[model samples]
Target: MSGFNNRNHAVLLPERLARFGPVEPGAKVKVRIPTEHRSLPFDQAIWPEEAAVLRTVSRHLPNVPKVLATRRGFSVQTFAEGTELAAIWGSKPNVKGGVVEGLASLFAALARIPVDELPKPPAGWPAFGDSTGFIHCLIDYTRTRVEAPAHARYGPLFGALGFPADALRRFSDGLPRDGLTPRPFVLLHADLHPRNLIYNEEDGSLHAIDWELAMVGDPVHDLAIHLCRTEYPNRGERQRFISAWHRAVRAANLPAVADYRRDLPWYVGYQRVRSVYTDVIRSVELLGPAPTGEELDARAAAVCRVLARAWAPVGLPGSPSLGGVRAALRDWAAERSEPGPPLADLRARLRRRLAEARTAFSGYFAGAPAPLPPDGPPASASRMRAR
Candidate 1:
């Protein structure tokens, strides 16, 4: 048994999770989520929000574990009991037509979520404006705050990547109003990274967990971010996911507000920058306790490289400049190649973990239903006041 505390309701795993290969399937385990604001003032609210969303999803989704147990700030559902995809990404062979098919199915499911029915960020949380505004925040955080130290350490590299300060702000300022239009708002799992996904070995069912940042917003926000992170430097894989998403949208019968294909490139860029800021913050926090100057320099270089790569256009949908992105990535990778200490290895390990997760996720689309149509006629692309 494990002890409970201010935030978590601790549950011990039936077997040691790490021993079962770091992540395992079918062994029962207890997990805890916060019931109070122990980590952040707003943390307590997230527990209830998660429970509510889980309930809604269970009710609507066929394969999800129905609610099994509950407590004040925590609930235990029958673990979907599957292999975490993050563990096996790099080694997986390319399955013909699988990646795109799976992603499209995932997008269609996301599109089906009724925007108004999902949870909201607390009263004063930072509002995500339109996608363009969304892009601006990414640039500001990365260029001004997140990547500041990195820029200082690797000034020449930053310039080489063409990532000047205020790059996002400048582009945002020059964009037309139409550029910022929000797709029809919908429920979004803001942090839809790989660890949050589990694939049941039994039936190849995909179960998504971790709803800490889940909220109502443009459905494309989640889709774009997922694709950007998963397919970033891989042109073939990226195109596959985009195609899958479109098919899923069409099949799910969800509203189609506009041509998602045309808007995808812009949104992909938006997500890349957003992810750069997020990753930098996480890296700094993880490398705690002022290490050697060499370590800090390497950390900074990594952040700069990611920003530069994020800014490189992945090519517009349907008009992929075949070898363009590949050459760019190769060049970026070659220029930044330098040996550093354990911190560089740590970053590499983390990235590998993400890649593994992407691999594990590849197996879950086996039974994806053909795309559904919009639930009804598409809603007009109108802006909503940031609440």
Candidate 2:
């Protein structure tokens, strides 16, 4: 057929969903649909690439799913039956080590994908797997365009976060200019947040969905992003997941996350800035004049918390003398010299950092937060940082 509706796409079938086994019931297939008109940047070529990624994944995971057919702009692939990990993450049973184990195995599979063999990201995408060099480009673009027009609204808020537009641009443009070169690349799912993770209760397995942004780059970025998500159940669960992940990576003979830990602060800071700009715009549209007072305060605080935690990690150093985010990074490395604190202690520290970040972001607590664009560059790069 020339065209098919989203519902009719064979990939949305119930039986196809069963193949995933342990997943919950009624899970929907999340394939990209082609756009008829120019809408968001994401609509441009996402489906084509998404389709390719799905097929590639199918090749590697032979038992995963199958595409019954394809339409001009749409294709049918097997659905995954399951509950989103985000839904019952804090609940009992699921909270134990089961979910962690499932995810660990799933991530191990993703980490092994050969990056050089995958489809390339859209044009102008910086290599180094999204966050590192790609983020620098995004901030540079934002500084040149978004920040100026929206200055009056965001100037104060940006100042409070210690991320004025000029400063961001300077940091981006001045990044070890040579850092732009691409190194060994690995296929990255980019987005592995709770919503995208499906846990099959029946078989006690996990399936990672959403591959629209897959690309090749450093594996540590992927682990860092996953680690950040696992950080949700407070720090205790986060540590267990990290320990599990460390063991898995080591056992699998995969690259470790130590390098990512070193550079994570910069990527985190980059995302924080991007979030402020994006959220500002979203708040403005969702609520006229943009969220202000307590709402604004809360939102700003959340953003700042992320910034503050990442600040020390990126600015301080391993040894004396080096300063800025780089120096902070060294300090963070030095702190891990111990055998690693108890999970509870790490959770407390993480919560404290989050609280501090919120305070820093909410300096404009009495007024409207900055107003910027609701969306930025394709999340492919930033999302990669998340992975």
Candidate 3:
């Protein structure tokens, strides 16, 4: 499935749609298909969804991609050439050099967005400045979408690993009894790690290419997730980015944002729990018909690390040791090498949702806004005449 770069498959269409307006036929165009997996429970979006996000954010940020066209299951975005950010940074993500500042600047730019400029956030979007509510919403989402949906298949694994069936709920219970101080919500490029970024060395610009996971939430939460997603090599590197973010967010003057430093750890703790589930589930998926000792050891080691971060926050029964974690993982694998329920039903539901998304897009925004009309000849016609 190719749409918003969360494992989507994008192809260069052979011909531009007539609606794409006049451009040289050779001008690039792309079509995206939302893979069946994209419809799975792990997938979701909030109010002011992707199209509206790109349309508005692109107006203020030049680097964001434009939504050129859309239909039921997928959309087309204006394509550009640049090196993928992952290719530059590779596996160990130092995210150093001017690139570090560039990343911080992107976060700052999002912080400056005037809420008045955006359409009303959906009914449940935590009122502006309700930072506590924002965190609650996230926890709720994990409980409902991430944990609950897959519980039937993964519940035993979670239990075997010492997590209570009510782990998320317990974690939720642990939030400060005194509500967090308010900080205005702002645009969050929730998935802005390297893969979703593209760098153009000729211009020294890093452009955000995916908006599907974009959200409006506490600014600190955004930074926390980014750091967690990227996993800083050392505490110094983490603080360095935080300093950069502080400067950028300060310059943006996003009220109460100055206080982000105090709350970063809590959000990071929250991220730890999220990582616990996602990483554990992924490890199970990696198991083979006959799991090799090395493979199991690697997976167990990874889970051990994440669990060490998450256990206290989640308030599991006892301290989790590496040996204990490895044993639990081995046991879970023995019982069910594969995690997750059957997919045929999920696929059917996904297909229906994609159809619904297409219909809704047509009604609300006329099937996504068409790109600028060709000022002169249609690209195809120009090619035909040349031939």
Which one is best on lDDT?
Answer: 3
Candidate 1 per-residue lDDT over residues 153-203, each given as its tens digit: 545544544455454554455445676555555566655545456666555
lDDT of 2 by residue, 1-387 (tens): 011112121122344434544433344433233323211121112225566776777667533444433444444455666776776876755455787876666656666666555676666766544445655655655565555644554454444345445545645654555553332445666556676676777876666765655655555556655655444657676768767766775565444354544565555555544444554433332222323446444434444455554344334223222123232332323332333234344334433433443343333122111221234222121121121
State the lDDT of candidate 3 residue by residue for 59-152, as single tens digits.
Answer: 7888877666677546666665677776676442544567789998999899888767766666877887899898888888888878775566
By TM-score, the candidates rank as 3, 2, 1
The candidate maximizing TM-score is 3
Alpha-carbon lDDT of model 3: 0.67
TM-score of every prediction relative to native: 0.58, 0.59, 0.80
**Residue runs of model 3 more than 4 Å from their true location after superposition:** 1-25, 38-40, 90-95, 316-318, 337-387
- Looking at model 3, residue 3 earns an lDDT score of 25
Overall local distance difference test of candidate 2: 0.48
Off by over 4 Å in 1: 1-29, 34-48, 65-72, 94-100, 120-168, 180-182, 231-233, 288-301, 310-387
Which residue pairs come into collision in candidate 3?
A: 1-8, 1-9, 1-35, 2-8, 2-9, 2-33, 25-379, 72-358
Ranking by lDDT: 3, 2, 1
